[model samples]
Target: MTQALPPLLDDDQAAFISGGVSISAAACRSGGLPSMARATGCRIAADRRSITILLSATASAGLIDDVRRNGAIAVVFSLPADHRTLQFKGGDARVVPLEPGDEALAERYVDAFAGGLEPLGYPTQVIRCVLACRPDDLTAISFTPSAAFLQTPGPDAGNALRSGA
Candidate 1:
């Protein structure tokens, strides 16, 4: 009997996918093209099977007096190795003005005092926080493997079998 193969991500080809660089690695595996878009530096409103990236754009002309506006960017991908396709949708992003002493506020959010004691002196605020809200900002990645490739077994398996177990 043929032994089951390990997950595709465990293969050498998967190294490129986790490197957080060029999408070409995944593309090659899927036998599909790769693409990328600039991240607006906005916080992630939500992350599920699909991720939402929020970006604030400047308003012009008679457009609503609101300076902050939301937009949606969609990404679709097919995983050839997995023989599956996925879709993602994102939108509902809003921009807000930068607040002063933002770094201090951020520290407060992350500060977790372990023991009970008098309030400790505040640390110097070194970061600033910008508020941006987005209900949805869609970006997607997918893959679809070829049937022939899926059915074919790697030579390594045959070698291991010949060597016993």
Candidate 2:
């Protein structure tokens, strides 16, 4: 019999995902082309099994279309200073309405992301521009990670991730 995989994200991984990091998403378009977009914020479900990403409906239109057509998605979160990265893959992504407080969540995310890059000499305005989104145009994409991978640049990069590790 095969060993069962970890059912949810461990505490450490959850913390990492909650920290100030740059979020981006990718979806496979029709005929295998790829659509990519920069995400403005992220939220993990209470169960730690699902993640919801906030994105600009206009900025991420192509990616949203791809996810609608095919539910495959891959999201990457990376810290600008250290380049620490993690990738989560799912085959059942879906676009959904934003929750009541999600607008504020997106605001905080933009602030934290800009602050994270400030020390590295990125102009605050530029950083904010990269993640700007109007509240009315914001959308959420939710997915349960079927697989996780360590995407940091190192010998261990690409290794499968396990909870509690």
Candidate 3:
């Protein structure tokens, strides 16, 4: 039998996901064509086995298609005030409709994100414009991470962490 793979994400990582930071989700398809979308919110499963990213329906068409066709995804979350970042690679991705309850999560995320942006010199209006969206236009992509990497700007930026080992 094979040794079990390590847990893909930790509690700290999960906090970053749902802590109202900027998230960028990407998917690649045939011939390595890539598509990306900014996520308004992130929700980690209670079991810590997966993540759900909330994105705009209109802006994520290509990304949705890419995930459907390839089932491969890479999500990057970056803290604006500092360059600290993490990237998670996942398989078994799927796009789904966001439920009614997801809207509140999005609202909380937008507010927290804007608060974080203030120290970075982005005004409230700019934050609103960047994250503004209607509930009807929101969709979710869920996936289980198979790999995680620390991408904070430094010598260790590209290094895969303990989980990916």
* Candidate achieving the largest lDDT: 2
- Tens digit per residue, CA lDDT, model 1, 62-104: 1112212323222222223332332233232222333343333
Better of 1 and 3 by lDDT: 3
What TM-score does each of the candidates earn?
0.20, 0.91, 0.91
lDDT of 2 by residue, 45-147 (tens): 8877788999999999999999999899999999989999999988889998889899999999998889988989989898798788888999999988888
Candidate 3 residue spans exceeding 4 A from truth: 1-6, 163-165
Alpha-carbon local distance difference test for all models: 0.23, 0.87, 0.84
Quote the lDDT for 114 in model 2. 90
Error of 3 at 1 (Å): 9.8
Ranking according to TM-score, highest score first: 2, 3, 1
Alpha-carbon runs more than 4 Å astray in model 2: 1-6, 163-165
Reference-based TM-score, model 3: 0.91
The Cα error of candidate 2 at residue 106, in Å, is 0.3
Predicted candidate 3 versus true structure: per-residue lDDT over 12-79, tens digit per residue: 98898788678999898878769998999998888777789998889889999999997999999988
